[model samples]
Target chain A: MELQEKLKILADSAKYDASCSSSGSNRKSGSGVGNTAIAGICHSFASDGRCISLLKILLTNCCIFDCKYCLNRKSNNIKRAIFTPEEICTLTLNFYRRNYIEGLFLSSGIIKNPDYTMELLIKTIFLLRNKYHFNGYIHAKAIPGASPKLLKKLGLLVDRLSANIELPTENGLKLLAPNKESKNVSQIMEYVKINQSKKYVPAGQSTQMIIGATKETDLQIMSKSANLYNQYHLKRVFYSAYVPINKDNLLPSLEHPPLIRENRLYQADWLLRYYNFKVTDLLDVKNPNFNILIDPKADWALRHLEEFPKEINTCSYNELLKIPGIGVKSARRIISSRRNFTIHLEDLKRMGVVLKRAKYFILCNGKYITNKEFFNKKFIERNVMLEERSLIPTNKEQLRLF
Target chain B: MNNIYIYDGDFISLLNIILYLLKNNLHPENIKTDVYHPSLFENTIYLSILKNEKIIDQIISAFGQYAMRSMYYVFLSKEENKELILYYFFQNALKRRHKIMYYHNLKCVSEVLRISNYVRHETHKMKGFLRFKELEKNILYAEMEPTNNILFLVSCHFVNRLKNEFWVIKDNKRKIISIYDKKQFVIVKEEEFKLSQKESKGEQNIEFLWRIFYKTIGIKERRNERCRMNFMPKKYWKYITEVKEEL
Candidate 1:
């Protein structure tokens, strides 16, 4: 097959993966072809709202496993093409010089076997590093059940490694992808965590689970993510809303990807990483899903209204962060700015805190300036939901942690 | 005492002006700095801040190297009050002795931070948004008109990434260009050039495939122009390879 044809098939197959970040690696240029900036860089955003940072393509579209939610499942008859290690290196160098991508994001179906596919991936990275002298950021998928020896060697070469947990629960895995196991994903994550100090996956490990694919509740997914984060020390847990690509018995045939749910999960994920929200603080078994009407932080604040009317002047940084609209940066600003000035509602506005949501939750100089009806749950929900409905977000960067 | 001072807008010159102001114990409000804007008044001292090594060392030690570099970036911004902002920050820094950089609540410190943020953010954005075309003589060329005076700030990043490749980044708006001859970037005023082969046939082939790949990957179900505009603003869309086809 021609190279263009092969790239189309491979890139089409790989697009479903949705991990388009070339971040976290501070690999500087030192007699090398490229550099990885610390915070990462997004080269382009596709019309689908996905980032095109790296050349996120598969080695080949051929697979041995038939994961039901996947586009390149073994049963589906699709075009398959494999790029040689030399081809991979040549393409990456060409693209890097042309400023087309940050680096390579090499993923593939289980070609023949896990070990065989991993060998091809490892060889490509080895050639790119040793022969081409490319020092750009590379985020490669760790083939599940690949030997720890190969995994360790490959881990050293790439900036970041991931073994996607595909589904949140063991039962979800069993139902959708019978051949794959959640344990297999965690094992590699555990391996990467152990080698973090040794510079194995220096950008740290990340994983993804397809939301809305399984019957698992939002609470279950969050708990699972919390367990994965706590146990494996993963840097990010991406939640890809299950974009139905197949007509299978196990898959959910939906008209659209659950983008709003995905966004909410991203918000919740942000809260977990940045804010002091534990998984339990956001939701419980009784409330399995987030209230889609408002954001996770506002939902949490409204539920715990007794905690509202907190004085901004005397509140701790942690307390400031818990309020609906105060993010990490703004909270720190509040802390530093309040040290010099007696903060009022006017001062809070200057600090870039979301005064619309925060007005319901905070007090400045013993004054609650917002409407008195804000004390009621329905009224608060209506106001907050109205604000959310109006927020037609101009841009949300594609290389998001969630 | 109200003799207005003019300055060429570089950090070294700005520092020299500050050094003279400090030595004279004159308030900075009596002075002004602009990048060669013609002054209406006569007898005004065009601030001749020279590259004196001894004073450079003194300035470095006084503000710390990070602050000096940051002040340079902040000055590069389109801030009208940049001179006054940097002056007040320096005045406070010299007074408090290094405590002023961390004093974010101060108006001078916050204003400096805001200007630095603009320069820093644009430099980072240019790192990604820049699109290079394969030209003749084995040269790579990327043309942009960034919002800030960010060409010099972002040059080092590209040089590091494409170390062994000869390339040039042209800032169409500022009429300045940086030429990287596989080692270091040498920025010059923008110059005109013709395409060597107009468009190499091989280059066209690769460009064709790139345009195709860019189109195929966007999931039609999840199309959001607002989100895309947020990342790759409309200003950059004219030159970006894949998105250009749509326009």
Candidate 2:
């Protein structure tokens, strides 16, 4: 096949993998041709609002394993094209020079075997860095069943690496991706983490978990993510909402992805990492999923109302951040403004804090500003629900499911 | 009454005029003109004075002594509030001392520096955000008329990123234009300029691609209308390749 034809086929096949980000590294060009910008280069945003920087493509679409949900799975008959190491290197350089892409995001199916495919992938990156001197960002996928030594060596060259935990739970993996094991995936992640700490992967590691594919609750998924963050020091844990492309009995037959669920999970994940909220804080066994109506932080604050009315004047930075509507910037502003003078309720309004949600949780000068008569739980819940309904346009299709 | 001073719309010529007016210990009521106006004019000075390169050099030197070479560009760009600059130049010329220009706490000097920084940062960020679409004859056209003198700064980013590509960045508000050759750049006053017929094809394709990409990427379930609107404002949609098609 022609090289352009191969590129089109490979890039199209690889587009479904929602892990195209050129961020998290601070690598600068040292008498080199290309430099990596710290803020990240978002070349384009795909139809799904995901940032596309790299020319994301698979080495080949041919796969040995018949992962039921994947378009490129073994059972699914599709045209496959594989780029040799030299072809891949030349394409990257040409694309980089033309300013079409920032780097290369190369992934592949287990073509022939995992080790053989990984070796080819590693050779392409090696040639790009050493022979071509392409110092721009390169994010290569860690083939799950590849050897530890190959994974370690590849980590040294690439900016970021990801071993996709395609499904949430072991059962999901068994039912959908029968050949893949949850344990093996986690072990690869662990190996990547160990190598990253030893300075092999300077950009750190990230993983993706497909949500709503199986019956796994948000709590279970978040627990796994929390553990991954704590254990491997993963840079990020991306959640992809499963869009059923293949007709499979094992997978849920959905017309569209559970986007709200995906969004809620991101919100919940944000609360965990930045807001200092725990997984348990977001959901318990009874409430294993996020409340779609209110944001995770607001939902938590509403449930734990006794923690409200903390004095903004004297509240520590950490304590101020715990408030639902207040973020790091507002928390810092509250701290800075208070140093100059006693902060009043009106002052907070001017500084751009959400008074409606904040008023329920904070005190301006030893006094709460929430409507005293309408300060009951039912009243607050009704108002919060009203606000949520106004915010989310009530996509009738999504609303129909409930 | 604050009178308006008009120049020939040449930046270097205006700098010389501002210096001459300041050296002669004359303060205009207000500098006003659709023509090129430099900073450091408190009062209006009409373009009655002949263009003098000698006077311009003296002013450039005055700015240079304080390592404020870029300040004159800001001045030429018509960044506001130059009354203190007028006072500083007048004071320094009278005393025959260059130290006054370097003197700290001069409100005009500080304001110019602050605005310069603001303009520079905004221009850099806009470089990343300014979406350019291909036109018919391979002309990359992007329209951004920012509130500040960010045109020159943004051009540098485009020039560096798109080295071999020929592109035009037009400021729709000022009608100022920056055209890039392979290596050189020229800023021209375009009273009325339209995208070439050849360039229109690239624009259409880019618009189509951007719209399709933007629609596909955003997860409907996680749509934060407020956040989305806040980051990508409707006002900017006219310049955005993707959002324009949807509109």
Candidate 3:
């Protein structure tokens, strides 16, 4: 096949792997060439409205394993093509110079077994770094069941590495992608974590969990994601809402991707990462799923009404962050502005706080309250639900899944 | 009297203007910079004796080098009354003992930051969107029309990335060329120099492949033009070759 034809097929197949970030690590060129930006840059957005940061493609679409949820399953009749190392290097360099991408995102479909695919990906990058002297940001996906020595060598060359937790639960992995096992994925993640340093996977490890693939609750998924963070020391746990590309009896056929639920999980994930909230704080046995009507923060605040009416002027930084609309930026602004002058509710808006939800939860001064009835759970929930109606996408289709 | 100081629109000149006004203990309202606009009153006096060495060192030590860079970007802002705003920012910044970076809630401080953030954001976007095509001379050539005069900032990133290659980044709006000849880059105007490009066969093939990849990667089930435009603005769609099909 022509290189262009191969590129089209491989890229189309690789679109299912949705971790497209090219961030975190800053690789220096040392007067050589190509450095990674401290904050990643988005070169373009695909028609799907996803950021095209990396040259995400597959080595080949030919597979030996029959994974029911995948487009490149062995049972599926699809066009397959494998890229030569030289072809990949040429494409990445041209794309980098033209500023088409940050670097390469190379994955495969069990091309001649796991080690062979991993070696091809590593060899392509080694040539890219040593001979071509291309020092751009690279993010490579690890093939499961690959040797530890190969994983170490692979980690040494790339800026960021990922071994996707394709399914949220091990049972989901078994039911859907029977040829694949969750243990192999974790093994690679563990290896990457141990070997990671400035020289190896400097951006650290990140993994993706397919949401709504099998019958997994938001609680189960989040608990799995939180455990991955604590155990693997992950940089990010990307949540990909399962896009029903296959019509198998095993997979749940959906007309639209579960966008609303996916969005709620991300909000809960953010609170887990930044808001210093434990998994238990966000989700309980009674509330197994996030409240789609209101945000996780607002939901938490409404349940714990004693924590409401946090004084904006004298509240601690962490205390202010607990409020629904007050983010890290606005929280810091409140802290600095309070030191100089008496901050009123009017000043809080200018400081970048979203007052729609925060007004119900905070007190600007000791005396002035936004609404006395804000203390009522029913009233607060009604207002938040109204706000969420405006927050929904203009059209029902979501721009991003992760 | 409104004492207007007419100096070159450089960072050092802004510092000189600030220091001159400070030494005279003049209020910020009385001091006006001639760089932006001229006042239509006879009471305005222009002072131009700006070859001072001691003032630069003193200002550097007092404001710190980082704050001086902030002033430079604030000066580049197209916002009206930037001089008066920056004047207030500097006065407040100095009074706070160089804790200006943290004064996010201050109106003047945030105003300076808002402009700098624009400069920073534009530079960051161009870093990823900059496309270099190899011509007949084997020189990598690219063109853009940025909202801000950010050629110096954007080229600094490219110099480190493509140090060994000969390349030129042309700012079509500002009509300036930042040309890098393998080692270092020099900014030249249209009067000084110009480079003509001839499309290479190899370049077309590579772009054809890239366009193919760009088209194939998009999942048709999720097409949100508004979200795409939010990140890769439509204004940039014309220059990005892969996005021309989108046009």
CAPRI-style class, candidate 1:
medium
TM-score preference between candidates 1 and 3, better one: 3
lDDT on C-alpha atoms for all candidate structures: 0.81, 0.71, 0.81
Candidate 2 local lDDT, B99-144, one digit each (tens):
4333223444445545555566555446545766566566666787
| Tens digit of per-residue lDDT, candidate 3, span B1-247 | 5555555656666666776676687765444455446557625556675566575566558767766677767666556666777778877876875567556667887778778777778888888787888887678888998888888988898888777788888988878999898779999895677667787668998888888988888888667677788888878777898896668
DockQ of 2: 0.13
User: Compared with the true structure, what per-residue lDDT tens digits does model 1 show for residues A23-49?
Assistant: 788887888788887888988899876
Q: Model 2 over residues A277-382: C-alpha lDDT tens digits? A: 8898888999988888778888888888887768988989888988877987778777766765687777676555888777777887888786666656687777
Q: Which ten residues in a row have the lowest lDDT in candidate 2 chain B?
A: B100-109
Task: Give the alpha carbon lDDT tens digit for every residue of A323-357 in model 3.
Answer: 99999888887887788778876667767788876
Q: Which candidate number would show the highest DockQ if scored against the true structure? A: 3
Ranking by DockQ: 3, 1, 2
Q: Choose 2 or 3, whichever is better by DockQ.
A: 3
The deviation in Å at residue A265 for candidate 2 is 0.6
